[model samples]
Target: MTVEEIHGVRVLTVPEAGPAIRGGADALDLVAASFEQQAEFVVVPVGRLDPEFFTLSNGLAGEFLQKLVNYRLRVAIVGDISAHVAASNALRDFVRESNRRGQNWFLATPAELSDRLAGEVEAGPEA
Candidate 1:
């Protein structure tokens, strides 16, 4: 577990070697981990997310992500979800909407995240 600061936000990058995040409870565990590390953003790589997370029909994505958001933690799902998006129009739409909301982001790469958020970080934490 490593938290790297990007665009003034401390991003907790979940390690790829850990157990897969299987459900909402697992997601909350991550929230706790972030708080312990004093991180404001939780960056989850695609490999860490279970396949169910990509299946919108099960609502795991909603349940899991909403829990994190409710805790006031920004989230960045980093990886290529193009294959999943290609399989479901609803997912494509969800990804588009999530990016626009700003509180959450579905970025393709670390470099892309850095570029997209550069000089665009919120001026304050509202702390």
Candidate 2:
């Protein structure tokens, strides 16, 4: 894992552990490690995500989201997820709710991520 701080948020490039291999414990471990290192937020830029990875059909994504909400750790997933989003209504709803709640964000590029983080910083805590 590589962590770079941008606008006070830690942008993390996590290793490709394969979607099928990740679970709730693994998500917790990653979040714990990031927090231990003093990250206010963590960004995972996955190159390719299997549709199953984001599904509520038993995977780490849902668990990780719940953990993030419970712990108040902001998270963002950056990459192309058009196919996955198209595959499941539940996942689409998850993305929408996460973004609406401001707990999680999803973007397609690094520049967009930086811009969004900057916007968040400017928007302040109430945002």
Give per-residue lDDT, candidate 1, residue 36: 96
For candidate 2, the 10 contiguous residues with the lowest summed lDDT are 15-24
Q: Score each candidate by Cα lDDT.
A: 0.86, 0.72
Q: List the residue pairs that clash in candidate 2.
A: none
> Which regions of candidate 2 are displaced past 4 Å?
16-21, 48-51
TM-score of each: 0.91, 0.80
RMSD of each: 2.4, 2.5
lDDT: which candidate is best? 1
What would the per-residue lDDT of candidate 2 be over residues 1-127, giving only the tens digit for each residue?
A: 6778898877665655644324566568767877777776766665534445777788568776677666667777888888888988988988888777667888787787788889989999898
